[model samples]
Every structure is written in structure tokens, then in C-alpha cells.
Target: MPFAVYVLGLAVFAQGTSEFMLSGLVSSIAADLGVPLSAAGLLTSAFAVGMVIGAPLMALFSRTWPRRRALLFFLAVFVAVHIAGALTPGYGVLLATRFVGAIANAGFWAVALTAAVAMVPDRLKGRATAVVVGGVTIACVVGVPAGAVLGERWGWRAAFWAVAAVSLPAFLAILRSVPGGPRPEAVPAPVSVRDELRVLTGPRLRPTLLTMALVQGATFCAFSYLEPLLTRATGLGAARVPAALALFGAGAFLGVTAAGRYAERWPTAFVTYGMAALALGWSALALTAARPLAVLALIPLLGMLAFGTGTALITRVLALAPGAPTLAGAFSTSAFNLGAAVGPWAGGLALDAGLGHRAPVWVSAVLMASALAVAGVRRADGTVSGVRVT
Candidate 1:
């Protein structure tokens, strides 16, 4: 892979950390500012909401800009949001800052990915894309957990401030490292709902979107409450949640790396089985009260199954999309965030219903199984190729 992939990875890591760290420190943030934990928790929701809004909206808006400028501009926005998050005083202000931040986050991904895919040669696109996504996976493994520790030590506000500091360097890395990407030579497409709708309505997109939405969606089911769930299982105090989160992240990293290596060769059948296994794992998490042992043993598998499917599913979509890889890529990311919205909201509802902590995990497990079913129907033998539009 080209060195630009690494720079992309770094920017991803910084953005991802900003996005997820709030989940771990929600209680602290709420207490510090005299708000309810639930209110504080909205930070995560804020980011997801941002992703949902930003994914399609930003994708449309960015069609005309030079890709490098778009990338840098969004990263700067991502950094500035973290600053706003750090410095903003009231709950309402914080919420507004995060919502705006999501806009930038969404745009950064849209443009970065559009650039990342275009920066590479055709044959290497799949692998190159994987390398870039690997940053998000790595962030899952490290960024959230590390941010948790930082929040715990320096305060949640401080954690956001630290991430804000990273933007400066990340921006520079983009200026120096990322290739003079495809924005220059490319003819900008006319942005229209009809254009995007036509892409979604295409034949092969059906199964591809289904596969990602379900499989990826299921992880959030378990992920949303992982901090508390594991804390109960492990019998650890709050301070230890970051370490557990880190372990889960490690599984994500390993799984993503393994996906790039074996997705081409295997039937990818095991990923569904992997989801089944994740369901069973969450079931174990639900059934056992020995929270410490269960979480330590089981949580990482959720990430493993989730990360492993990424390459297989993405390559499948790119193959399915044929001529419209950028739209397909944005759509895939859009689907993931859509799942992101569903996962936490589902978990939160379960928690609010007095269903006990494990309810969300179990429900998500079933969702994963559903995703597996969708994927199981896909003909692995029929490699979906990209469509070329004149």
C-alpha cells in the first residue's frame, strides 16, 4: 500500500476517537457539568446523527470541490468541533457543538474515502480501501479506550481537548502526505436525489446493502452498553472500562487485518457463523452474572465478527456497484452509520424499558443473526462486478 494510506489512517484514528470516547465518559461529563448522564450521553448520538446527516448531504455538496481542499476543510472542522466540545460550557452549547462536529465528521469521511479510493490504482482499490478503514477499526481498538482513560484522568473535557490538538498534525499530514488525489482529473458528477436513488435501486445494491446494514448494525447492539455490561461482568470499577474497551478494540484490529488477507479466498461463510457465534456470545453475556469473566471472554468476539465481515462485504458492494464505486462507497458508509443510529437507540430503549442491561446485547445478537441470514442468501460464487456508466 502507498504511504498515503497511513496518513489517511491517522486522520481516521483522530476522528474516530473524537466520535467514540464520549460513550465511556458520559457519566463523568454529566456529573461535571451538572447534567443527567443520559443528556451527557447524547454526545455519541450527536455524532451518529451527524454521520447520518453528513453522509448523504456532504456527499452531495462535496461533488464540486477539489478533493484535497474538501478533505482538509472537513478535518479542520472535525478538529474545531473537538475544541468546541472541550470549551463549550452549557449542555445545550455542547450538544450544538457536537451536532455541527458531526457535519464535519460526515464530510471528512465522504471526501477522504472518495479521495482514498481514487488515489489508488484499480486492482489495489479494495486493499487500499481496507487499509484506510483499518484506521477506524484501529480506533475502535485503541482510540475509544485510550480516550476513556484520558477522560478519567484529565477529565472528559480534557480528553476532547487532547483530540483537538491532534487535528493540527493530522491536517499537516494530509497536506504533505496524501496524494494530489482524484479531484483534479475527474469530471464532477451532477448531484441529484435521482442520481443517488438510481444507484440504490440498482439490482446488486439490494443484497450488498442488506449484508452491511444487518451485520454492522448488530455490533452496535452489543457495543452501546459494553462499558456497563463489562463493568458488571468483570467486577471492575469504572476506571477499568477503558482497558476492556481496548481489548475489544484489539480484536477489531486483528479481525480487520485478517479480513484483507483471507476475504478473497474464503467463502466468507464463517462471518455469518461468526455473527451466530457473536449472538451466542452475547447470550453468554446475558446468561452469566459473573460479569468480569463473561465480558473478558466474550466482548472481543463481537468486534472480531464485526471487523472480519468488512472487507468481504465492501468488496462485494464495489463489485456489485460496477461503475459507481464512489457512490457505492459513500452508501456503504451511510449504511454503517444508519446502523450506528439504530444500535445505540435500540440499546437505550431496552435499558429504559427496565429490561435489565443484557436485553440490548441479546436483541442485537438476534439482529446479527438476521444479518447473517441476509448474507447467507448472497451467492458468493457470483462475484458482482462494477457497472460502467457512459
Candidate 2:
């Protein structure tokens, strides 16, 4: 409900949209740039690699700045990076620009997650985090679809340009509406690096991170190559890809809101059930492409389940490492980007092998199944104190 939370959410929305819209546009970009689609998709990995590297770096460097300034600076970088991505002369240049944008993204999410928790009342932090984090969910629903449509109608370059255009206003919104750095201390700043390691390496932190890797990886594995998957499997045209993306995004939005509302009562089981649902939905999705309508119908349900797990996961981490929530949140964000990086890279291998289109989705189902197993393992221990991670 606070203005800061809303602006934080908008920043996330822009980042999330940029992160995902590429899937819908990859095919077109590949064609435009005279490259393979697999190679085009690799740009996502390049960006993700930037995030993976930038996460800890931002955590280490930005800890000293006023949190609000750190965020605004990143948004400025984000706008610059997207503009570069749009105007680049070659595919390689585009990837480099996106990589820089990805670094900005890492800072945005890291700060946004920590700020959301600090800005809200203790009892409401979970929901507040969800509201802020839901930017990604909304991105899945609106940003991806819209970007894809724009790319299809105009060109993929248009998508990146649009993302850059949005960043200016988002930056202005944060600057005007959010309080600056040296805001209230969320908690006593610990001995920055040492305390961060202690909390991150502590008991609750390890498994929760593992859980995040599995769940987030599984989602990316299926989703990174999703446009090709649907096109190949369902014989859908380029124009329809955005609509399919919209379906998945719609489902995720529902899943996030629903999970956030209920997660406080039974965090572990909620994640457990959500993982189970993801496996089922992914399995169903992989096989249902022959029935395109049915496949499209199921995407939202899949998104709802696959993406909703974050609400409980982040809340759990904050609970376990109350004093060290920022680093924990950073780790989780890194895990998601790591997953994003790996999914497409691995899927590209399978795709390169001349495997049919459904391979990535099928592999994603297996990944989801593995994620479920990991969730069960965490549940069995009952030692998980902080976040659920995935």
C-alpha cells in the first residue's frame, strides 16, 4: 500500500518484463540477425550471467550507499543498457548490452526485496514482499506478451526500445516517490561481509538455496525455449506466441497472489504442494501440444503453480535469518538468474542435437520432478528455518 513499495514493484516489473519478453522475440531476432534461434536465445544466458556475477558484487558494493540511490543508479544503467541493446549493430553487441542491463537487474531485485521487507510492518512483510516481488509475475502476464506482440509487428528491436522507454518514467517515479538512502535502518547493519556469510552459510541458508536452484531451474528449463516449444509442438505461428505467453503469465499472476495470501499458515506444505502442481502442469503441458487450445488453456495454471512458490520461499528465508535477510534475498535472486542461465544453455544443447521441439518441455518436467524431490527432502529435515529458497 505504501508508495515506496509501489515504485519498487514498478522497477521489478520493468526488469521482469525485459527478462522474459525475449522468449517471444528470440525466433524473430534470430531471423533478423541471420542466426540460429538457439544462438539468439543464448542472449538470455549472457544477460543472466551478468546477473549471477552482479548479484554478490552489488550486495558487496551497494551495501554502503543509501539503498534508494543504489536502486536509482541501477535503473539509470538499466535504461542505458536497453537502449544499447536496441541500437546495437550486431547480435554480439546486443548480448553485451543485455548483459549490462542484467547487472542493473541484479541490483534492482536485490535492493527491492530487502527494501520491501524493511519498509513494511513485521506482520505484513511477507505480503509486502509479495507485492513487490509480484512485479515479476505481472511481467510474465503483461510485459512478455506485450513485448512479443510489438516485436512481431514491428521488430525485436522495438521490444528493447520499449523497455528502455519505460525505464525513464520508472526512474522518475522512484526518484520522486521513494525516500532516499540513509532511510531508517532496516536492522542493525551487521559487519557487512562477515555477517552476510554467516547468515548465508548457516544451516537454514544452504538447503533453502538448493531448493531455489531446483525450482527456479526447472521453470527456466521449460520456459527459456517456450516459444519454440509451442511453435514446434502446436504448429502455432509467430503472432500467436505472445498470446500463449499471456496465458502462462496470467496463470502465474494468480498463483503468486493466491500463494502469498495463504503461505503464512503453512509455508513448507504450501511449497511442497506447489512443486507437485508444477510437475503435473509441466508434464501435462509437454504432452498436450497436439491439442493447441488445451495447451494454451493450461499455461496459466502452470504459471500460477510454478511461480507462486516464491512467496513462501522468500518469507521463510526472512524468518530464518531475520537479521540477514538482504543477503539471503540476494542469494535467492542469484539462484533464479542462475536457473535462468542454465535452463536455456542446457536446453540449447538438447535443441542443437536435432531433438524435436518438445524436448525442452519434457526435460523441464523431469527438472520439475527433481525439484519436487528436493522440496520433499527439505520438508523431511524440518530444520529449514529461513526461506524455502525455490
Cα lDDT tens digits for candidate 2, 1-390: 688787888888888889878877888889988899879978877778988888777866677677779889889989988888788769888878888888889988887888777877777777777787789888887888789779979999999888888777778888887777573544345445777789887766677777767777777788777888778788889778767877877877777777667777777788888878777887888788778888888877778887788567777776677656457667777877777777766776788888878777777777778876765666566545544433
**Residue pairs of candidate 2 with colliding backbone atoms:** 212-390, 251-300, 251-304, 252-304, 316-386, 316-387, 317-386, 317-387
Candidate 2 RMSD to the real structure: 3.2
TM-score of model 2 (CA atoms): 0.89
For candidate 1, the clash count comes to: 9
lDDT of 1 by residue, 1-390 (tens): 777677877888888888777877889989888998778877778888888778767766766667777778888887877787788778888898888888888777766765676777766665666676788878777777778778888898888887887778878988887765455534565445565567766655776687677766777777778767766644678777766777777888777776666664552564555667766766777787465776676667767767777555765565555455346566777777878788777887888898877778877877777776765555442444433311
Model 2 clashing-pair count: 8
lDDT of 2 at 48: 85
